[model samples]
Target: MTLLLSGVDSFTGIHPFLLVLAAAGLDRLVGDPRWCLHPVVVMGWWIRRLQQLSERWAGDRPWALRLAGGVITALLVGGSGGAGWLLEQWALGRGLSDLRPAGLLALWIALTSALAGRSLEQAVRSVLQALPDVAAARTALSWIVGRDTTELNQAEIVRAAAETASENAVDGLFAPLFWMLVGAGLWSVGYGGAPGPLALAWGFKAASTLDSMLGYRQGTLLWLGTAGARLDDLLVWLPCRLVALSLPLATGCGPGGCLQGLVAALRDGVPDPSPNAGVSQAAYAHAAGVQLGGLNRYGDQLKVKPLLAAGSPRPNPAAVERMLRLSLRLELLWLLAGLALGIAISAVGSVQ
Candidate 1:
C-alpha cells in the first residue's frame, strides 16, 4: 500500500500532455471487446447469483432479503476492491515506471477498458444502421438499452438511442474516472498505486450490478434491490450532472443552449423515476433540440415518463449519430481534464 501510494505520487509529477497522449494511444490499441470478461460483468454475474440464492432462502420475507442483499453487496464490493488493490500492488512492484511511455501503455489500456467508449460507439452505430429496418433497429437498440424497442417509431428509436448515449456518457466514462482520481489521491497519500482506484471501481461495479439485478420496482426485487439502487444513484449523482453540464462543450451545443437545456431538463425530467438519469437526458434533449421522454416498457411494465425538452424537433437516425459524436467528444474532454488535474497535483506536490 505504501509503495503504491508513493509510486502514484511520483508518477503524478509527469507532464499532462504526455500522460494524455499515452493514455489515448493505449486506449486506441486496446478497444473494447465483446467476449472479454470485464470485471463489471463478472461482478454482475456473482451478484445475480447471490440474489437468486437469497431469494430461495428468504422466500417471501422482504426485510430478510433486503438485509441479506445489503450485506452481500458490501462484501462483494469490498472484496473485489481489496483483490484489485493487491493485484495492482504486485504489478507496480514489478518496477513499472508510473509515467514512462511503456508504463503509460498499461495505464492507458486500463483507462480505456474502464471507459467503454468504443463499445458504446459500436452499440450506437449498430442502432443507427438498423434504423432503416424497424425490426433490425429494435434488435440493435435492445443491445444497449433496457427498454422494449418493438413498438418504437423512427423518432422514438432515435430518441431512445440518443438518450442511452447521453446517459451512458456519465456511467461509462466520467464515473470511473472520478473514482480513479479519488484512488490516485489516496495513492499519493501513501496507500499504494492503483489499488485505491481499482477498489473504488470494484465498489461501483458491485453497486451497479445490484442495481441491475434487483433494482427493479417489480416483484421480489423492489425491497432487495432498493438499497443497492439508492446507493448507485447517490454515487453517480455528481458525475451524471457534471457530464450533463459538460455535454454542451463536448457536443458544440454552446452555452445558451446548454443552460436552456439544463433548465428545461430540470422542469421536465424531475417527474421521471430515476433520480440521476434525467440530468443528462434533459441536457441532451435540450442541446440537440429534440424532445425525449414518453412511454417506455421494460418487459410487461409500462412507465410513462415526463418529456424532456418538450416540443423540440423529432429525432431521426442522423440525430442518433450526432448524439454519438457528442458523447465521444465529451468523454475525450473528460479524459483530458483528468490527465491535466492528475499531472498538476503531482507537479505541485513534487515542487513542495
Candidate 2:
C-alpha cells in the first residue's frame, strides 16, 4: 500500500489522488488538441496500415482473413501496452532527476489524451447546435455515432446523442481510471512502478479504435473486424457493469431509485444484443426517465432495438443537455471514490 503510493509518487512526483485530479482537470479543460499527435490517431494509422497489408497477404480466403485480423488485433492491443510500459521504464531509468518536471509534463499530456470527456460533450453539442436542420444534424451526428442519420427525427437525434454520451462515459472515462488504479495497487505490492494500469488503459484505447475502424457488417472487414470487436467487448464488460450500477449513486437518485434504475436497465438493456453498451445506455435512460432506443437505420437496413423508456417522456434538448452534465458528474464521482479508497488504504497501513 505504502509501496504502491510511493511508486505512484516516484513515477508522477505527486500523490495518486492528486495525479488523478490533475489528469481529470486536464481532460476537462484541454480536450484532444488538434496540434498534438494523439495516441488514438497513431493507433488508427497503424490499424489502417495493418488492414491494407493483411488484405493483400491473406488473399480471399475467409479463414485466412480472420486469422490475419486476429494477429493484427493481438499485435496492436498488446503493443500499445508494451509501448507504455517501455516509456515508464525509460522515464524511470534514464531520465535524470533534473529532468523530472519534463517527464511529468510529458506523462500529463499523455494521460490527458487518454480521456474523452470534453471532446464527447463537444460532439453532442455539435449536433445540438445544428438542430432543426435535419441535413446539418445528420452531418454532425455522423461525427459521433455509427448510425445512418438520414431518416432520424429531431427527438430521435436527441435520444441518439444522449445514448452516445451515456455509453461513451464508460468507455472514455470510468474504465481507464479503474484499470490505472488497479495497476497502481499492483505497484505497491513490490512491483517496480507497475506499468500494467496505464498499459491496459491505452490498450483499451487501441482495441476501441480498431473496433471502430473495422467492425462493420457491410465491408471487406466483416471477418477481420471480429477480433477487434470481440476484444473491445471483453475489455469493457466489467467496467460497463460498474458504471451502470454506480449511475444511481453518482447522480444522487437515492437507493430505491437506484435499485429501480438497475432493474429497468437489466430488463431493457438485456435484449439490446450488445453485451456492454446496453448496460450504460439502459441505466442512463432509466435514471433520467427518458426513452432511448427504437427503430433506426444504419444504412438501407433498419434495426428495431428495444425502447428504453416505453410510454414515458422522450428526451428533448434539455434532457440531452442534462445527460451531458451527468456524464461530467460521473467523472468527478469516480475521483471521489478513488480518493476514498486511497484514504482507506492509508488508514489500514497506519493500523498495521
Over 4 Å off, model 1 = 1-9, 14-30, 94-110, 188-195, 253-261
Cα error, candidate 1, residue 237 (Å): 0.4
lDDT of 2 by residue, 1-352 (tens): 3433234333332244555568779989988888889999999999999999999988777888899989999999999987776554444442234235655676666767778888888888999999988789978998888788877888888888888988888788777777766654554333555674556678888888888899775556878889999998888888877777778876787766666666777888888878878778888887677888888787778889888767779888888888887777777887777767666666665577
- Candidate 2's C-alpha runs over 4 A off are 1-14, 92-99, 188-190, 255-257
The residue pairs found clashing in candidate 2 are 4-188
Candidate 1: tens digits of C-alpha lDDT, residues 19-126: 344544454456576676677777777887887888888888889878877877777777777765655554455233533554444544554555566677788888
Q: What local distance difference test score does each model get?
A: 0.69, 0.76
Per-candidate TM equals 0.86, 0.90
Instruction: TM-score for candidate 2, please give it.
Output: 0.90
Error of 2 at 34 (Å): 1.0
